[model samples]
Target: MKEYKFLRILDKFEKIYTKIGVDYDKMRLILSMKLTLDSRRTSTIMQDQNKNNNEEDKNIFNRALIIYAIMGIFIGITAMVSFNNMYKFSILFGMFMFLVLTIFISDFSNVLLDIRDKNIIGTKGIDNKTINAAKITHICYYIFLTSLALSWLAIIGSFRQSPLVGIIFILELIVIDVFMIVLTALLYLLVLRVFDGEKVKDIINFAQIALVIIMTISYQFLGRMFDIVDLNIIYKSKIWNLFFPPMWFAAPIYAIEGGHINQIIIALIVLAIIVPIIAIILYIKNTSKFENSLSKLNIAKDNEKEKKRGLFYKIGRNLCFNNEEKAVYDLSTSIIKKEREFKLMTYPSLGFVVIFPLLFILIFSVDSFSEIKNISLHMSLNIYWFIFMVPTILMALQYSKDYKAAWIYQSTFVNDKRNIYKGAYKAVISNLLLPLYLLESIMFIVIFGMKVIPILIIGFIFMLIFIVIQHIISKNKLPFTLKMGEIDKGQNIISTLLGMVILGVAVGVNYFILINTYLLIIYGVILTIITFIMWKKCILDFSTN
Candidate 1:
């Protein structure tokens, strides 16, 4: 039995050697082949291990997927119910869903593309080639064209039953197409080339901001014009089409029938006369100073860098002379600036706020003073809550981004460990949290007016407290450097639970204190005191770190 087992083992070894391209007679060759084969097998095993690890992580976060699925079902059911009622609510809900889905998908795709771009950097292999600038530009152009074409097609399709309507639609489409083509071309030139400096590789960043502002103003004017113009005449008149474009001609007719023809004509004449003058002035001004301005900006940046270096050196020299408190404060300020990027790219979802408010006002048409007052109160409350929540979420995201970038390198400079922690805490508050709160306050005041000033003050105080609590929880409990996609889901869960608890307590406190003008003042004062104490403690804690 022992002899048989030995023979079987030898046979297995021989088969293994032969399968791995090894010659049994040549011992050295056989050994080398075995080593190579073993290495490859080990690599394959490691890859499989990693795959299993990723799968495990996905399983751990399976709840996120379930939550999203549930949300989808709820929204779908609500939409169906609204549709059955024959209310425009269903249509609005459908549009909202479409917008949200599109935005999320597009944003996520962009994130993936960015990661791919980063991975491909400096890779020379053909298989790992990066997307070129021309390819990106082409893709953007195609997306724009396809969207425009689809919009035109949808409009035309809706008017298929009426030849006159179809004709008007076609004429309108042509005018819009011509205007957009010219506007886009001009925008591309002005923003992509004119503003792009040596340091700016992504001209799209600046172009997007300019495009938003231009589109907002343009649409406002177009809507007014459409109220005045006669679509039929505008469609039929070749001369008017050539001179004014279909959109411009149609607007006046629409406005005329809508009893705003005089206003529309006056606005159009003013725009026609002023637009060229403004364009000429801007062109001349930019052309004359563009090179000089760019040179100066570069020089200023260099000087700024030098100043930072000098300040660092000075701090280093005076390390022993200055009190720890002052040193911590200065370090924290620097860290905040570094982390926040000085609000260069930190803006709330302006598109959501703009579009939603306009739609709400238009659809509801609250003409009565009482109705308007109620809307103002309800909207004010909702807006404040949204403002508080959205910014907190965004600030969390900003923290994640900075953390992922390994910005803790700046902390390495500080000798005191307490100061390091302090710096980080201060950085988040000063840079990310403060600006958002300030913006929220501005938006609230604009929307709600001075009547709710007391409420606004109280709300602001509560928001600050919430922010501090969130920061403490995030810092101590949650891991830094979360993936961008995961942050929103994670934040939603935490914020919902915590926000409800806090709001519940706040409501109880307000009721206990009395819910009138005096209550507002009292709440505001209490909030102010709490905010001050919390802030001071935060600063002290940060400094110690």
Candidate 2:
């Protein structure tokens, strides 16, 4: 047999995991080999750079992976310090799981259900059980790598506290991690079986985005909760702990460390045992069905229906651009709504947009009703931070995996490059910025009352001016027309910093100088005129030729 390119990586994993289960490890090795080969092939990293030059690229990638893991260790340390030494084991264990769980849901979910793997591996004589087990264990290998980096600091702290607690902590970490990997795999299988196989790919993409949002909000919300109360209060609250997944693992830690071995501890242990067993049984039993489903997944279903036109088409069209720009508008819209790579780059900003304002409210708002009224005031000012998303969206708009396909823009006759710029500008505003602004606006209005409407309006106009100027600077590049790696990273960082500074000044002026309704209306009109002039100059100034 010809040795596969990925055989070396798989052999490394196989030597360790083989002790766990021979058949599963073998399948995992094969699946890992296939997935690694597929990824390298798609990434075209080694394709562009031959064996002679690729050594540096490989080193760069390994260095990046190590840096990411180091960042995780820092997060674990942060979580540890925040707990102030109370419920040391629970806090440490919870921090590790929290980091891993977020990474699993937000990052690894797609890897788990990569349709390429299903299509390639399923066609072989491999049984569904082996294939399914292979995917789970492959994910485990990744989590294990992450765990090694994430757990070391926490584990050292545990040992420093008590040897028994340290030992139990390691044991609980293994159980919870295995339990998490199995449970997540089962969820992927369930989603695959329930949704159309072709659609499952898209469903997983959106599911990952949704998970990022949930994780961001939960992290901020929990951080606030932890600040207000001691870690012990949270651990002891049966009601709170029931809803918390980390607490489930922490229950044993609590039991081992002098807490009563009561119904809750018993329940946690039973669940710890039962959930993985059930996941394993269900996965094994449905292995054939799962394989059959994957095979049939690509078959088109006649029952699928066309989605109706959305509000973006109706309202955003009129707000941003004219008829000549619709081609650019529609192209940009399709790319954002459909492009997975675009979403992967852009969605992190969306998470921060939503998370930051909520964090501002949490951090600044005092206990008094009057002071609470000021929360919305702070939110209205902070919401202008979303102005930065427009520039980020524009920067992201320039890159694509299929960037070569963008040659059509050059070949086809384009009357004016301005239409393309106008359309893309509106697409970012309408699709990304407008929705975010509206969400923040409504949130501020409900909390601060109707008075916030003026501040939001003023802030919106300045943001309009800000993105318009930023667009003019950046509009030379067409949407999805450049390879992601080809974009000027230094220029992007400078533009992003400038955007933050400009937005900061605008928010300060609005919050302080434009407080009155008359001043706001006058400023809004002046800024609106400036925005219009900037848009006109922006389109005319840039030329694709």
The estimated TM-scores of all candidates read 0.46, 0.80
Clashes per candidate (backbone, < 3 Å): 21, 0
> Model 1 Cα RMSD, Å?
16.7
Encode model 1's per-residue lDDT on 1-545: one tens digit a residue.
01223234344556543453334334323223333332332121011222333231223223333444444454444323311111112122223223332322222223212323323332432111112221222233323333333343333332442455345434443333333433433443354345434223234333433444344433332222222254321212122222332234333323333323454445543444444445534533343132223232121122324434544434432433335434544554453333322222332243333344444443354543355535545444443443335334434433333445444534446454444343444444454445545565575566566765666566656766766665554443222333332333355557557766776677566545533777678778888998878755752222112
lDDT of each: 0.39, 0.63
Locate the minimum summed-lDDT window of 10 residues in model 2: 41-50
Alpha-carbon shift of residue 396 in model 2 (angstroms): 2.5
RMSD of every prediction: 16.7, 4.9
The stretch of ten residues in a row with the least summed lDDT in candidate 1 is 41-50
Candidate 1 stretches greater than 4 Å from native:
1-190, 197-379, 390-448, 474-492, 504-515, 537-545
Residues 437-468 of candidate 2: C-alpha lDDT, one tens digit per residue: 88888877877898778778877888778867
| Candidate No. with top TM-score | 2
